[model samples]
Target: MAKIHSHFDHVGSYLRPQALKEAREAFAQGKISKEELLDIQDRLVKELVHHQVENGLEVISDGEFGRSWWHLDFLWELTGFEAYQQEASYKFHGAKTRTTNVRLNGQVAENPNHPFYRDFEYLLSITPAGVTPKVTIPSPSLVIKRDHRSDLYADYYESWTDFLDGLAKAYHDTIQRFYDLGARYVQLDDTTWAYLIQQLETYQDQPEQRRIYEEIAEDDVYVINKALEGLPEDLTVATHICRGNFKSTYLFEGSYQTVAKYLGQLNYDIFFLEYDDERSGDFAPIVDIWNGRDQVELVLGVITSKDPALEDIDAVIDRIQEAAKLIPLKNIGISTQCGFASTEEGNILTEEDEWKKLRLIKTITDQVWG
Candidate 1:
């Protein structure tokens, strides 16, 4: 629907490593206060904003540097939620459940000074006079999934319907606020749908959980579309769905087939689907779903972020052609499977390697879309 524009997911690396390392080491040794650390975080934020714009990137994020974790800290920072730490067993690929204490929500508060609000304000203030920068927030669907604690919520919220209703309302309000502050592109980073796909084979074993996940997928679409409902039509919205890209370990593995219903019916203007490897299965399902929809756009993730080796240009082009066979070539574009750093702990690649990967993406985009 638009010209061949290029954007990336999770581009900002870390909180300016040099400043962070110095500040962290000093703070750990009792040389700096929390305020001082946050001050350094602010400086790093500016540097990151500049770096993202300078890297030939049109869409920019805070690189998620200010917070400790990507999803929870920001969700915790928002008003209307009291977050506390709890350890749980979450599986990733072949590994056993690792004990990680992530933030869980209890209540919602109202405030004019939310961290995400301030994060967007600060970025807007520092952005060069004319450049429009995009702000990313974890998908409300994923946030609800992350905050799902059966023990705490089953008693208070009483039923799944009430809980999801509130969850959807919170997100709708949050996006409204962001839109008021000049956010043109709001990318919802989510993996819940992928998680559902990954556990498909075992669905029969947990019939109730399967039902819950199915509802979650539909709720995910409903919440996003609800949030987008009265907003300016030009405020381009897109979604980046992934199979948990943490430490290169995955939580889901399958093709676009598992989630084709939602993918085909999603109300967003654009969909960024993962097709970097066999772990993502085939593109045939998406091609079938996308049939006859000229308005929806697809970003084909042809470059793999899992390894350091660069992809052969010809092979990359061939993959694009394969995907184009399913979805119209005009509706498809290209990008990496995931970001260089989906979390605070960056991926295994060196910073230089990350740029190389991006350069290749740019090169291929120029050749294919031009």
Candidate 2:
């Protein structure tokens, strides 16, 4: 809703050093109370919001302050699910696999309260005098990726139509409730579709797995479209798709060509695509759907958030100009390739370094869009 743009990342760094150190130590010793943890989070979040506003960012997020991982924990809050840490491994760059018993799943046990709404409610108290805050949540489609849920079986919803419809309703209800509370922008952090597109090889290696991957991609679009069925025409809803961002490295790397057809049909107001490096591929495929009738805007990730190196503002402007050849400049904007903190593990950059990246993005954007 604001004219200036900002990147989303971790809120942990925004905490007062003493408070953060205390929280970490207390959690480690299992000596902290939930209320104490939340209280510190609240103070940190308020400061985070003020910091963003001061730094010249247009839209503000809670910096995903309270959650551990961006997608999973929120997916757990959706409905009929429980989450727990479990042993699992993910392939990192250089073909290295990291194994950790991180948070995995249980079931869609009950429809507990949505964290997006509760967090926003807490954030409302800290919003700056005039700035409108933006809320970001993992896409509802992420539920498909959560550690094997029993209810999501072969005949889970009686029919594919029923399953999709339910998903749409749940997301729509959740987002609408937030909109009703004065949120002008709601962003769906959809890494599921992006990952499916990039990991085709991983799925293709096993015939049995390919079908599940295809179904999830198709169903993600269906569910997202369904959720957007009816809502405020003026409320801006955006989607940020990334291959994966963990500890300054990536998991999947590819372009939109794999899912371009479905991606072109999404119903969001804007699409924040990761185009920071060669791994994202050329922008030609994106140009194909850039002028579609659905009224989608493109928030180009021209600045690399993963590395500490600052982009030459002149070169960044040239790329934006280059992208305009395919899509109108009016429909384009710039941001970091992904959030400063896609996960708690965070990018390898220091807090000072991370903010420097944001500053560069803001400076370049002012030059190009001003």
Against the reference, the lDDT scores of all candidates come to: 0.68, 0.70
- For residues 1-370, what per-residue lDDT tens digits would candidate 2 score against the true structure? 3332233222122213346557856876889987787788788887777777777775777877777667766666766455654465666674333342222232222243676677888887677766667788877776655435334433446665765576678778878888887777788887776678756656767878887777777888788988888878768788888777777788777777777777887887778888899888888877654646435678888777778889888988898888888877777778887887766556767667767877787787777777
Model 2 TM-score (2 dp)? 0.86
Give Cα distance to truth, residue 298, candidate 1, Å.
Answer: 1.4
lDDT by residue (tens digit), candidate 1, 124-234: 878886466666777767655654532355545768667666666667677777878877777777777787786554584788867877776787777667666776666
User: How many pairs of residues in model 1 come into backbone collision?
Assistant: 3
- Model 2, runs deviating above 4 Å: 1-18, 21-25, 94-112, 145-151, 154-156, 201-213
Q: List the residue pairs that clash in candidate 2.
A: 9-341, 80-108, 80-109, 81-107, 81-108, 81-109
Q: For every candidate structure, what is the RMSD over all alpha carbons to the true structure, in angstroms?
A: 3.2, 3.9
